[model samples]
Target: MSADSKESSVRLIITGRVQGVWYRAWFMEKAINLALSGWIRNLNDGSVEAVVSGLRENVEEMKKTSWSGPPLAKVDNIDVGIYKEKIVNSGFRQLPTK
Candidate 1:
């Protein structure tokens, strides 16, 4: 949230053995560590969905690490999209399944 730095946000739909493998928890931890803001949740479709917003460089780092996820997760694919808005007053959290 600074004038000099560009904000970057992304919607990540992670698939393949992501749910039930601590992905959301891991995501929360990683996002916080990166000083990013957003939320992560489980989708009924068996994929994990997350929205991350922060510094452009931080967002890029998140994308690089999130592809691998936690050790137990078998990440087959990640559907990445440009997220336009930041979640209001929200920090990184693990949301209930949607």
Candidate 2:
């Protein structure tokens, strides 16, 4: 699909109290529930990064959910950007820190 379409991809870099709070697991659960295809991982900069691709509505929902992360997370900011790469996977996963 084209990048301009609604069914696209987004990379989210979420900061603040995100680490050590099961944020990646939470994100994985939500993304899988939404039937999204992508992966989430912890970054070296104490942030959580995720690449989510699916229906625009589901992806948007995931973005909104990222703000409230797992109750223990205090999300300060989420830098959302378009991700041009396509996801070859079929389910959500938690990748190793990068």
Candidate 3:
């Protein structure tokens, strides 16, 4: 399969009022709905981090939707980068804070 046709993964570091607003849960729900596989967690720096893996289109959509997180979250910025590693989990999950 062509590279573009395969699943893609990205590591997103979302900042600005992301924590404490149920961002992780919201993200998990979105991932599940998108039929994605990966994990979401909260960092100690008040930012939310997630590794999303899925079809290229789905991954792109997730990246866009991340900017407008949960209703209570005031998302300032999202740092997105290609995640080279594979996602072992078969389904999306919400992990403990780091």
Candidate 4:
């Protein structure tokens, strides 16, 4: 599928002070606002990882938003990868830290 086409999933790895800053909650809010389906969680490496699925524009917006997280969050870098899958259909969620 083209970049502009509606995507089903977008995996992201956000680094920096993303953990312990309500980043997961903030991300869930953003995803819900965009009517996206996905989940956010803190990784064992102190980074935040997420997989969002929705319209192309919404997923793109989510990726952009990850660069500038919640006001208390200091996002250093955001890595994004898009994928075409059928594993997402639920609403946004803030997963437990791993």
The residue-by-residue lDDT of candidate 3 on 1-98, one tens digit each, is 24756689899999999888888888899989999899988898989889999888999999999998899999999999988886875998888889
Please count the clashing residue pairs in each candidate, in the order shown: 0, 0, 0, 0
Better of 1 and 3 by TM-score: 3
Task: Report the Cα lDDT for residue 13, model 2.
Answer: 96
Give all candidate RMSDs, comma-separated.
2.4, 1.2, 1.5, 2.0
Model 1, 1-98: lDDT tens digits are 54565887789999999988898999899999999999999999999999999889999999989888888998999889987664664678888899
- The candidate 4 region of ten consecutive residues with least summed lDDT is 1-10
Highest lDDT model number: 2
Q: Per-candidate TM vs. native?
A: 0.89, 0.93, 0.92, 0.86
Estimate the TM-score for candidate 1: 0.89
Give candidate 4's total backbone clashes.
0
lDDT of each: 0.88, 0.90, 0.89, 0.83
Off by over 4 Å in 3: none
Ranking by lDDT: 2, 3, 1, 4
Selected candidate, larger lDDT, 1 vs 3: 3
Query: After superposition, which runs of candidate 1 have C-alpha atoms over 4 Å from their true positions?
Result: 1-5
